[model samples]
Target: MEKQLIISVGREFGSGGHVIAEDLAGRFNLPLYDYNLLEHIAEEKDVAHEGLKKYDEKPKSKLFSRTVRGHSNSIQEHVAQMQFDYLRQMANEGKSFVVVGRCAEYILKGNPGLVTIFILGDKDCKVKRVMEKYGLSEREAQQMCKKEDWERKYYHNYFCPGQWGDSRNYDLSVNSSRLGLEKTADMLERFIRTKMQL
Candidate 1:
């Protein structure tokens, strides 16, 4: 049987991380679990897709709620759990897939086939990308970038404190600004090929 291969991508906001993840998935012919993970959880008759969509990747929910499994958890906690649970199920089923954000790296820790990658770039580079993509002024883009990055940090650290953006935790760390998005994806494909063969 082939080994399970999971690529967990953690990235800074506006770093073109999602694009790179898509590139990697295409090169490897693996499934990318982003919004579809939410859809997976939403299939449960009792779980509300709108509820998960509303809070997807936002900061920790302040209100505690009961999970369908009957555990008392914050809304954020419950939603995050349902996603992680699905990832585990996929892994256990020996499926290889790539997951972006939602702290998949930490949540899927201990899986031998997991490849953890963190994507970051210079502030100017990221801000420029945001401005171009969102058609916002420089200052507005800067504010949005700052707000989203902090929210992602707070969200990630809420579950795994002090772990976000720590280069030590990731098997590979890339600066898309330095390599450019295409080159970065090409380089990562090479790395994943060699890494997975071991």
Candidate 2:
């Protein structure tokens, strides 16, 4: 029987990490949990889907401070816990899947047959991709990238309490800029297959 594997991907803004995850899932016929994970949690917890969407991969802002403190536990805390529990349940089921973001690497720590990957790209390449993907000007793309990456870093640190995107946090760190998109996905697929001895 093939070994069950869990692939968790952490990535920088506009780094093609989502594309890479999609490729891997397609190649390996694995289930993918990304934004859809938020939907699932929202439905299961009976929380507002919009609320989950707003806080998804975003750090808490001062604007929400009073709202968060109004409850016994903040919505962000509840959502985080739900995501962690849902991921743990999936892993415990011996499912082979690919999860993008939501701090899967930290949550799935010590799980057998888990491979954590962090993907990053050069600023120029990322900015170009963002400009093309979002139909934005170069300057606009740069600004968006900077702001989103900062938010991602802050969100990860706030939830996981560690250096976001630090090489030490993952099993592999791939420079999508160096390999480009297709090649980077191909490389990661090969690496995961090899690690799983498939």
Candidate 3:
């Protein structure tokens, strides 16, 4: 019985995290769980998939005060927990997967076979990618990147109770800015094989 590989990716926005996950999944024949996870959870929980997308990978601000009480978890908190639950269930069932954000590293922290990686890039590289992908001005892309980064940090702190982007929190942290996409993927693929003793 071989241990399944479960890769949890924490990434900066516009850093090509999803692209790397997709490539890894295709290369390794594993399931990639990104936004599609919301759809699956929505169907399971009878909630609108769009609702999950709206809050997916982000923290509840004052705007969501109604959904994230301190003394107790709210509906949004509950849903997020459910998503984590589903992720674990999938892994326990022997499925190899690449999960994007959603505090997945924290969710599966103690699993010995888990490979946690944080993906980040230089601000200029991220801005350029954002601008090209969304046709935004450089300034606009930079702003969006900063905003998303803050949200990811807040969400992780709230749910995972850990610092975001701290290399200590992850098994590996890769700078896609320096390595570029293909090289980063290749390096990570090799690293995973080495770590798993495959």
TM-score of each: 0.90, 0.90, 0.90
| TM-score between candidate 3 and the true structure | 0.90
lDDT of 2 at 41: 74
Residue-level lDDT tens digits of model 1 in 46-164: 56687677677777655545445756567677677778788888888788999999888888888988999999999999999999999999999999999999988988987774478
Q: Would you list the C-alpha lDDT of every candidate in the order shown?
A: 0.86, 0.86, 0.84
**Candidate 2 stretches greater than 4 Å from native:** 45-48, 66-73
lDDT of 2 by residue, 3-54 (tens): 8888999999999999999988888888899878988777887876875776
Off by over 4 Å in 3: 63-75
lDDT winner among the candidates? 2
Report the lDDT tens digits of candidate 3 across residue range 1-198: 266888888899989987888888877788889878989877887877876576676576555556325453455566677788999898777777889988888898877778999899988899999999999999999999999898888888888767999899898999998989998999999998899876
In order, what is each prediction's RMSD in angstroms? 2.8, 2.5, 2.2
The alpha-carbon deviation from the true structure for residue 170 of candidate 2, after best TM-score superposition, in angstroms, is 0.6
